[model samples]
Target chain A: MTADVRDVWTYLADTPLLGLTATLIAWDAASWIWRRARMTPLLNPVLLAIVMIVIFLSATGIDYRRYFAGAQFIHFLLGPATVALAIPLYRQIHALRRSALAVTIALAFGSVTAAASAVGIAWALGASRSTILSLAPKSATTPIAMGIAKEIGGLPSLTAVLVLLTGIVGATMGPWLLAKLKVADPRAQGLALGVASHGIGTARALQSGEVAGAFSGLAMGLNGLATAILVPLLVRWLLN
Target chain B: MLSYITVLLGCQLAGETIVRLLGIPIPGPVVGMVVLFLLLAIRGGVPEGLDKVGRALLLNLSLLFVPAGVGVMVYLQRIAKEWLPISAALVIGTLITIAVTGLAMSALVKGRRQ
Candidate 1:
């Protein structure tokens, strides 16, 4: 019995498929929980999935590098997936065109406010400079947040965690926050969710309606651009 | 399908190139997204294969984060040690971001209406 168990462990460790299997299981478990809970944001699929994978790997004494080695195919697809966001944005081009000025201004103000308040509050609360940097771009999508973190001397790994947490929080509390403020328009809800939360919020917005999804998509794209330009420039200005 | 793969690869390459040349602090995919946006804006539509590839990619987006999520293992100690500070920052920062951005966007839209 012990020999069989050891063999199984060795097989899992040797093949990348074990990591992929873990990924699928975690995602499915998260989806099941979300469905049972009526799509509560706190039961966010990504957060739940990550928790599941972490617990599994830690328990089995498997290292992350081995898991990632088998899972690089999935990671490689993120590039295309991000680029695909433009298609939805393209479909909503007319609406985006009409709201060009509004989107631009909202993005500018929102991006600055998002980055500044995070760094300021973190610093005020006595976080290290690296922690402040990690938190600065938490509102943006994962990739951009990671880049900003690296540029400003934060730990990329920490920023990734912060990014995931930001998404989960935004997805979970976003609707409630909007409702409390009496912001009922789907477009407004979607845009707010996307700008503040990024892809995860947009996923939640998709459940509302196509219009909401469209606006959310627009917000996501514009926020990415706004933060991309403004975060580094602002950091440079502030630090210098 | 092949065409979609080509365009996807092409755009990704172009995006990486632009980022390196411009010294943009953003990721390559983000820059590719911007480039794709421009191309669509100029051409007035996404090429056919591009749409299919994009849809496929988006549907499976969650899976892509698996590797990164696993990387969390590397920071277990940091997270354990700094749980309070990290959680505080995330919770507080998210609330502020939601409140300020939500209000600011609502006001901006309302101002436009007025």
Candidate 2:
């Protein structure tokens, strides 16, 4: 019986199924808890899932690389899902056009502020140069942020983690902060979330309403562009 | 659903090709989003099947980040070394960015209306 159980473990480890199953199970369990907890932002499903998976991997003596070998299947879908952002964006095309100028101004400021503030605070707090660079693009989506971090002399992997943390922070605290500030407009609120948090914030915005979701999507995309352009320039001026 | 997936992946492929060719700084998927948006605009309507697929994908969007988020464990040592600065910057910077952007956008929109 012991030999058979070890054999089964070895077989599962050799394939992607274990990693895939773990990811799904962790997310489902996290989501269930989130829902049961009254959907509080404090209990963010993604954050919960990550914590659970990390604990699981650590306990099992499994490394992230092995887990990612299976999780990559889900990760690859991020690309197509990003492309699908067009659907909600298209649904709100008219509204987008109507607020083009407002979006442009808001995005310009938000993008610059997002990168600058993160970098500034980190620098003042005595983080290293590469760390500062990685944190600079935290507001952009993961792929774009990772790319920018590489271009600007930072660890891409570290940047990816910072971007994730930024998203969680933004998604969890952003709506409440906005409400406190009396930024009651859905478009504005969504745009802020996207600019500050990227896709995760956009996910939170989607729960608010379609209008907020659409604008959040728009803000996320534009913030990527603006941050990509601005961060390099800011790096040159601030770092060099 | 398959066709919708095809269109999305195709656009992303084209976008990746374009970015590589032009050395564009933006990610390919974002450009693919633009291409998809344009295509939908030209068609003047979203097909029901495509809409369903898109919604399903977006609905589960947060789940997609799970893999990457879990990968944070790999950087545990680096993060632990800079935990204070990192945490402060993430929390404070994000809140300030949200406030600045939200306030600016709302004010601008209201000004435009006036």
Candidate 3:
């Protein structure tokens, strides 16, 4: 039985189907659990699915590169999805116009604060420079964060993982924390979540309402742009 | 759907070109997004087909990250070695970021109200 199962696994793994199928299955299973949990923020479907897939791959001894070959299909959606953010932003033109200046200010302040504090904390904790650089872009969306990390001497792969963790944490705890802070405005809530967490937090913000989702998308994009420009200059000035 | 996608990819390509030409460090897609947003604002509305396609993409946005997130497996050794600082920075930094951005924006937004 063991030998037969091993043969079956090898056949599947040899094709491009394994990673693609595993990702869908893992997310489907995660969504099931998330639904079972009544969509609790703590069981964020992305985080749950990542944990599930990581464990399966580790247990099966499938190389991460091999799995990524198939999984990259879904990954292609990020570009289009990011571009798609324009739709929601377009939809919220009236409200966005009202809060435009405020959003800009918040994004600038928030972006600098998040990156500086993370780099500062990591530096104080004795993390290596590479690790600190990797941590600096954690609040931006994954691609931008990875790109900035590479430009700044950080390992892109390490930054990728840190970015995911940052997003997951932001999505999970943001709303609860905001409520505690008496932050009642959706624009502020969504903008904060986006600046701090990027796409994953924007996903969570979408669940709140169109207004929040729109602003979150705005913040996510603006923060990505800001972080790209700001982190390097800040690092040069402050760290050097 | 296809034309709408083309427009998006086209903008992304333009963004990449602009970034490379100008030596800007931001990701291509983000500039792609800004370009698309500006075009739509000038047009005064999202086209129905593009709106539908874009909405579908955003609705399922989280799925796109799973592949990258799986790369965590490759860093198990590093994570194991530095879990303390890594975890501390993530949790503490995230909370502070959320608090600062939210409060600062709220304060500014409220200032606008008064």
Candidate 4:
């Protein structure tokens, strides 16, 4: 009995596949729950997946590095998947073209407000400068947010967390809030999802309809560019 | 099916090539998307299988984020030490984002009417 148990432990420890298995299992489980909950934003798949992965890792005595080795395949897909968002965006080109000015303005305003308010509010709350810097770019996509965070002296890892949380909160409350405010225009819905939630929210928007998906994609791209430019400049000005 | 796969792969390749050649800082996937869009636009419509593949890809989109989220473990200590700041930033940033975006979009739409 002892030998059998020891062999299982050794296998789990040595094999990188364990982590991938764990991640998929957790993701599927979370999906089931979220779907059962009828896709409530509060019970978002990303949030639930993270929770499940954490609990599974801890309980199984597996370290994250080992798990990540097997899971990087999925990670590698993120870049390509993000690029694929353009298909839906392209399909809605007519709608996007019509709202070009609106989207451009929204991205500019949304990107600036997202960074400034985060820094200002954090500073007011007595957080350290580094914390404020990291928080400044939370609403942008991960890569841009990380770059901004690093440039402004904030922790990239912490900024990553903030990014995920931002996505979740955006995906969760966005549609509900939009409906409540009687914002029926798909363009508006798409723009809100993209600017606030980034990629994940865009994914959610895609499910809503083609027009919403395209606008969200536009928001994702423009917001990313705006933050990439504005965040560094803002931080430079603030620090100086 | 084969044609769809070919186009998808071609788009991915073209995307990477453009990014590398142009030295663009944007994500490769985003670039790939741009190329795919241009191709579709020029052709005047998405090819049949493209939609199916795109749908499959988007549907399982959340799965792709799993690995990155797990990467968060490396920053466990940093997260704990800066929990307050992180949380404050996320919550407040979200509110500001929603408000600014919603208002700006609403105003833009409204302005167009006038």
Which candidate ranks first by DockQ, i.e. highest? 3
Which sections of candidate 4 miss by over 4 Å?
A119-137, A141-160, A171-186, A199-218, A225-240, B1-25
Worst 10 residues of 4 chain A by lDDT: A77-86
For candidate 3, give the docking quality class from DockQ: medium
Candidate 2 deviant stretches above 4 angstroms: A143-157, A179-186, A199-214, A236-240
Q: What fraction of correct interface contacts does each candidate retain?
A: 0.57, 0.77, 0.73, 0.54
Rank by DockQ, descending? 3, 2, 1, 4
Q: List the residue pairs that clash in candidate 1.
A: A41-A172
Compared with the true structure, what per-residue lDDT tens digits does model 3 show for residues A102-216? Answer: 8888888899888988988888888877788889989988877876887788877688778878988898889999999999999899998999999779889999998788888
**TM-score per candidate:** 0.90, 0.89, 0.88, 0.81
On TM-score, who's better, 3 or 4? Answer: 3
For model 2, residues B16-108, the per-residue Cα lDDT tens digits are 888789986656787788888889989998899889888888889878878877877878887889988898889999999999999999999
- The order of the candidates by lDDT, greatest first, is 2, 3, 1, 4
Query: On a 0 to 100 scale, what is the lDDT of residue A40 in model 1?
Result: 71
Clashing pairs in 2: none
User: Taking the tens digit of each residue's C-alpha lDDT, what string does model 1 give over A1-240?
Assistant: 999999998987879998878888888888899889987777777778888888888898888888887777777777777777778767776766877776677667677777887777777767766677777888887766776677677776677778878888888888888889887777678778888888888888999898778888788877876787788888778767
DockQ versus reference, model 1: 0.61
The interface root-mean-square deviations, each candidate in sequence, come to 2.0, 2.3, 2.2, 3.3
Judged by whole-model lDDT over C-alpha atoms, candidate 1 comes out at: 0.77
Q: State the lDDT of candidate 3 residue by residue for B5-72, as single tens digits.
A: 89888888888888889987666777788899999989988899998888788778777777887887
Compose the digit string of candidate 2's lDDT tens values, residues A132-159.
9889999998767876787778877677
Q: Compared with the true structure, what per-residue lDDT tens digits does model 1 show for residues B29-105?
A: 77888788888888987777778778888877766766676677787887777676677777777766666666766
